[model samples]
Target: MVISPPEKPTRDEKQSAGRNVAIVALFAALGGMLYGYDTGIISGALPKMSAQWGIDHTRQEIVTAAILAGAVIGALVGGSLSKRLGRRKTIFIIACVFAVGVVACALAVDAWMMTFCRLFLGLAVGACSQIVPTYIAELAPPQRRGAMVTFFNIAIGVGIFLANLVSVVAAAGDSPEASSNWRWMIGIAVFPALVLAAAMLQLPETPRWLIENGTVGKARVVLRWMRPNRTAAVEETLQIWAISQQEDKESRGGWANLTQRWARPALIAGLGIAAFTQLSGLEMMIYYSHTILGTAAGFDAGLVVWSGLGIAAVYLIFTAVGERLVDVVGRRRLMLTLIPGSTVFLFGFGLMFVLTDHPNRYLTLALMLAYMACNAAGLQAVGWLLGSELYPLSIRDRATSLHAVALWGSNLVLTLTALSTIDGLGLGPAFVMYAGFNLLSFVFVYFAVPETKGHSLEDIEQSLRDGTFLPLRGNIASRIGLPDNRITTGAAAD
Candidate 1:
């Protein structure tokens, strides 16, 4: 009978490992920071770029839509690249591209050149949109995973706020048409991208990805690093290994697999949430903050930039609160609760336009701040994490690609058409249209989104395979005074 293998690490060893994992996750979140900076910087740069280039609304639409167009391609291809090269490597590549694109935008001689540069940057942003949430979720433990992954989104909001603040300071006491100032606003993002690339060199690949590639021993080592104790680490390693082996045996490849009954609902939920995330009018708010304040509220460039800072501050504040509460409150509940409130604000925001023959800048500002708070506390924090975690492990990356495609695709369409809609439909009606979109988003979340607060990745996969992953019937029906009709008490026929 010989000595059995050691059962546990020493307490000191466990503590050290947990500390290391946390440090790594914090660094990995830099990717989200870069994503936010690149996206947010452009919002501030656009006005000066338009001034310098003498660009019309159509060209403004093209310039803004270019990055989104690149993001669409990036989202579609990012999963495949991550599948081939691994997440950390793909992210490093994205960081490099972001650096190059940011510099290119800052130095571009014309609107067309700037548009092309943005296209390159969008590719990286789009890839980060898929990769960061997916990467964070795979590394975190179930009990704290929701909050952990949401930290990535919170980083994004912070980056956005900081980028806008920089713009405010950069433009302060300067003419609106100053050419070099926009370049500085656009170029400052390169520092974060550089930091992200440097930080990634120190992080490990996710354990599930390692196990899937036949590195079970290494996967166990990483889990031990993340978990608080021995039993938990071993148990999770077994759980991940067992599920991965089965998924490899039965999981089909490619989009065709999503047509299967067990896979369809998750795909629908993934893509629907993605599409609705953009349709929440987030891009319009962030990208066009200047335009909305100017057109509807009659604010000058200086006033608009100051108001942009206010919106960014509100966004950052609530996103932090949402990050902490995502696990405590549950994803579906948080989204369902906040979206209706955001819709109300969206309508009120539009109504301010309707009531005022001229601009009621303060009232519009109040409504915008309230809307930002609801969005940050709910949709903006929840959407990326949900899409990353909802699919089966076998097809997660591929499904994420398509889901991200829908996200950026929706973003592109909205950004391209926002000015036109405001022109064609009037600012009040345009706001009303956004309010309608927000209302539909609430209905969709109510009827379709599932709660994934405490479930492990493997448990969620098994639930999807069994057609029991969605609509949280007991909870939803209870909330609405109806029977739990959405619950699947028995197996599907297929």
Candidate 2:
């Protein structure tokens, strides 16, 4: 059955398709923004909630950890929903949840009510973390995939930065009316939620997913919109069709597939990275910088709130930097370079706490910002990207579900125990413990993680089947026998 391939697309068609992909990716990345705002808002709102509700420290911890509990459940269930409903629909559902949950939180009358509302909101947060990167990765071309998927990460930083900025503004006045400002902080997320829901209604399903589901005709249409021309679109659609058929014949895609010997490396890398991302203590800083600074470090109230704003800015800036460098430097090398610096900065931050009850404010702030730059640019940037890209297509949805569970579960444990840990061990020892975790993360990456820069998703899958996924030989690209052009710009012309 020989057939002629379609002609290459015209220059105008290529430019148009590029614009379509970019627009879609940006709209979908709004899911990440909602995830960030909903989760990060709590840090600033919690103190106000405590002041208004007269909740004790134990109750305050419960309120903060509530959403985390729901996130675990959301991650657990997101796999089935994504597989059955499709990514676009699942995201729409997540958006609706975000909208409803935020409104409920804003209307809460007591601590328990707030906990219940945030718990409900966490479902969307957890699902957004799991699904948005995968959706973006599936939409983008191999060369641009790193940057596109990272748009979700960047949007998250945007949400967090906005949350902190709002908190700073809300905290400006000292009257009793200030206690009510938490409602505004929590409620503002509804607008973005509504916006995301509207956007998802217009975006196309990823061609890879359509091919997987045996709708080659529709997949070809989608590829046309995403790729440069008719020829490129048909070629990619055929490739995906071939891979999907082969996977169907050889494997049943589900939890059981995760246990196969060939899938073990990906499982180890994806799950390990997910856990390490949370255990790095970046979330602790995002969620509790004010507590760490004001209560533990003896900073004034204004400085504490403003320090949170500074922390958020550093995260947003470095995550943007990492987006540009991920493909150029390669993922494994970038992590290796930045993680050690994170270890050093965190260690220095802890040492100051140990040395003096009143550590110099500027020194502590400097160390925190430095730690943030290293952590955000490295582990934080790569964690979600790797999770979205690492697994074989057959098991991608289920694998990402498990990845989300590991991330949210680790986060839940950390947030639940952070205040108690600090109270019991003191801030110095607690931070030192986190620094040790960063060192351990470095060791894990060096031994097990492989560089995936400039490789196609199918290419990575083939490496797994061939038992050549590990970087045990040759230069980074040559380890996988990639062409030099792919190793560089991911374009044949390069």
Candidate 3:
């Protein structure tokens, strides 16, 4: 009998070899915390800033959205920069930028100056949002990739939760002096930003990025760092290198490459998924939650604080569930399940808003919570993950950058429009608009989006090129020509 050599350990097997990947993921996730803290802090801090600066609603919206606007630019620039400078380096730069922006925000003396500072901070937040998940995805083993990248969303929820909790505590004292504590709320981010920046010094650069840049030796070193004892580290590195070389040979990997015939559908799918995710009106609810709760639901400030906390908590929980289910049910299935659920919730919430004369505060709050739960369980958790997964590694950075810009740009517009829409059309009409957007999303996903669970990046690229919108599941190992048992028979098998 011929004896066969032992099978090589795949990336997924290496995931359990040590805690290095987890540690790296944790540090990278700090960038997400800053993204969340900065965005959500404005919700509570805006009212205080408006009083101090004596700005009108329009001006206040501008201040609140200045960071988002800056993020649009940051996402575009950061995506391209990460491709050149490497993911780890790009995120390090983002951390430093965040630290600077936080300090500037804390020290601003006037509304114009504060807006200026916010624009600066927005760039950091935008860059973090774009780069952190990509970095985590690139570094993570495919088996745990979804869970690892989901940390970004988790960090975001935590950031928002902490911001709200701090704001409530800071505003506890009943006096003029107590009201200005919002500044401190915004300033607290500086500590985390600084910590994130400092921690990046110890993390390894992404092995994939290294290989893409013709630094194979460096890539091997980094791979070893991630999987110290796995002999398959070098094999996986070579496989990735082969894929990158093939991509480069076929396409020059330029901006024009994304517009080529083979890449267009992937681009459209990425951008559409991202845009529809925002169109769900989640950011609008996030930015104006306090105002909406107080005005539409007739909840007081104390109730708004509690409600905000509840929203964050529920968001975190559902997002966790979504993360676990993403690899199991596949991206398309998750979208199919969650989009209709979100739409129904939004429609009912809209009707409730329209039907009741002086709607019951608790009932309205409950409906809003239901809407948030649906969003968190679906769009918020899956959107970024799907966007990151849909594109080939060749144009992944550019595609992700474009998608981030679209999402944040839509968020900027929605944030700016929320107060106006509420003032002009009332809460019911505003929700009705979101309900329509969600309905449209349901149609788009059902028709256009493909399932990507368990497919390798290379396999996904082939599927996109072949115009197969649905994933071909089962025996993916043989279909993709990967070794049987290379990946554990777990959620990936589903």
Backbone Cα, N, C clashes tallied per candidate: 0, 0, 0
Clashing pairs in 3: none
> All candidates' TM-scores?
0.93, 0.94, 0.91
lDDT of 2 by residue, 1-494 (tens): 98886676788988898898899889999998888788888888888888888887788788988998899889878877988888899999999999999999999999989899989999999888888898889889888888888888899999999999999999888762247988988998999999999999999998888887778999899888899887888778887888798799555646788888898888998999999999999987788887788788888888888899999999999999999889788788888899999999999998888888788899989999999999999999999999998899888988999999999999999998998998998898899999999999987887667778888788778778877776554465444423221222222221
Q: Residue 185, candidate 3: how far off, in angstroms?
A: 0.3
Which is better, 1 or 3, measured by lDDT?
1
Comparing candidate 2 with candidate 3, which one achieves the higher lDDT? 2
Residue pairs clashing in model 2 are none
The order by descending lDDT is 2, 1, 3
- lDDT for 346 (candidate 1): 85
User: Which segments of model 3 are wrong by more than 4 Å?
Assistant: 1-4, 7-18, 176-178, 227-231, 250-253, 469-494
User: CA lDDT of each candidate?
Assistant: 0.82, 0.86, 0.79
Steric clash count of candidate 1: 0
Question: What TM-score would candidate 2 get against the native?
Answer: 0.94
Over 1-494, each residue of candidate 3 has an lDDT whose tens digit, in order, gives: 99888567666656555478889888999988888889888877877777777888788888888998999999999998998898888998999899889888989998899999999998888778888988888777666677778888888888888887776786677852226777778887888988888888888888878888889998887777776454657876977887788788654747777777777767877788788878899767877787788766678778887888787777777877887887776667777778878888888777777887577777777877788888887878888887767788888888889989988898888888888887788788778888999999876765556666676665567666665643334554554421121212222443
lDDT at residue 218 of model 3 (Cα atoms)? 88
Between prediction 1 and prediction 3, which has the larger TM-score?
1
